[model samples]
Target: MTLAQRTPAEEAPAGASYPDLRWFPPGTHITVRGLKKAFDGNPVYVGFDIDLPKGKIVSVFGPNGCGKSTFINMVAGLLPIDAGQILFEGKTIAETRIGYVFQNYREALFPWLRAIDNIHYPLRLMGIGKAERERRIEELVAGFDLKFDLHRYPYQMSGGQQQTVSIMRSLVIEPEVLFLDEPFSALDYEMTLIMRDQLQKVLVARGVTTVLVSHDLEEAVYLADKVLMLTRRPSRIADYMDVDLPRPRDPSTLTDPRFIDLKARTLEVFQNAVRAS
Candidate 1:
């Protein structure tokens, strides 16, 4: 399962510019086929295949060590695929602009830089002009209605604030394929609720095709337009479910009979996966 470790080098070169972003358009659906990966000769994923729909939130649910992050990292071009293709808009991952939010918000954002600078960092790397960079930041903040003081440093802000910056950083580019690896796992109860609502609003409005990995059943069902249930190691999609719930999912969505039923079904499959593994 070992391939060349330098696959990331094949992506858009460091000095290259970010491509034009299409606003209000649902980006391409990602198509994966015969995907394979291994770390230190240990297979984590094998023949993993799924089609992530356009402008939809697909929450990936699985037990611990199921290679959720690994799958996403490979798609984000942060890690190389040993075998198979991950296609989006007729191009490979290396050819596309990707947005990834790591689970560890504490380590994701640079401590020395201000929150505004952190959001601006990705745009900076892409050689975005100051004017254009400011425009992107303004659009993202205003669109999300985020009120965090970006002038403060990451260490100076609350955990929720720091994670918000991480999310903003990942999203500044408005990538077609956005990978959120346990994006809210570090937040408090109140912050989680806020982030979930905020994420739904922005993503739904802009129509980014998001893939989220989460352990929280309620959160998964709450935010997802669909859910991809994965098995244990050497993971594969056990079931693909359409949410069938109404939009603008609020606190009331939790009490809806359909939501409760779907949540229970997802949990049962997850528990079965844990034991079968």
Candidate 2:
């Protein structure tokens, strides 16, 4: 029988065990069901299920090798899944417009292209005309309150600047979903703080559904509307906690009682997940 004709009970083959088919909750932008992945016979995800909310930043965090990157990569269609389905607003990945910011900014950006052209590359690929691409770049430049010259090559810019260009390139497409994998882990403490605030501002203003894979617990909680923690390989959800702390979070928010408390709770869950591994 076709999927549309099958009831939830009929989703699995007769006499076989399977996860119940569940509908996406209201406001869910991404739906992952029965997701499975393996590497060299080692399972990374098995029957994983999750619903990420629309226009919200959800941070994925956990112990080392918990499939945080794997999860996002699968969702982004950068890596193929072994089984099951992932959809954006009920549409398949190929039908969705998505952007991804890799952790390595230096490699992510093209050294040969000026920063502006780098940002324009994706737009060009999408068949956007020069005038329209210029318009979008200007919008991003204004939104980012950019100070550095876009005429410079990636190798000439500072680490933070290069990362900013990478982000702009990803965003210039005006994607429906954005994935960031440890975008700031390479920066020094001060630069990391700056980028965090800048990124938070633009993301909130744009209201894009974002999935972030971060190793730093503090960064994860600080930037997220919800924190999705994962257990080790064959990964499952360890904890999916909401960050009720107000937005436009700043340096001071780091020390806010609520932020501190939530971060501690997330850390506790993370530690437990690690120990269980």
- Per-residue lDDT over 32-83 for candidate 2, one digit per residue giving the tens place of the 0 to 100 score: 8889999999999889989999999999999998899989999999999999
Whole-model lDDT, model 1: 0.84
Q: On residues 26-61, what C-alpha lDDT tens digit does candidate 1 reach at each position? A: 444787767999889988888877778888999988
Report, for every candidate in turn, its global Cα lDDT versus the true structure.
0.84, 0.91
Name the 10 consecutive residues with the lowest summed lDDT in model 1. 1-10
Model 2 misplaced regions, further than 4 Å: 1-22
- lDDT measured at residue 106 in model 1 versus the true structure, 0 to 100: 92
Error of 1 at 275 (Å): 2.5
Query: What TM-score would every model get versus the actual structure?
Result: 0.87, 0.93
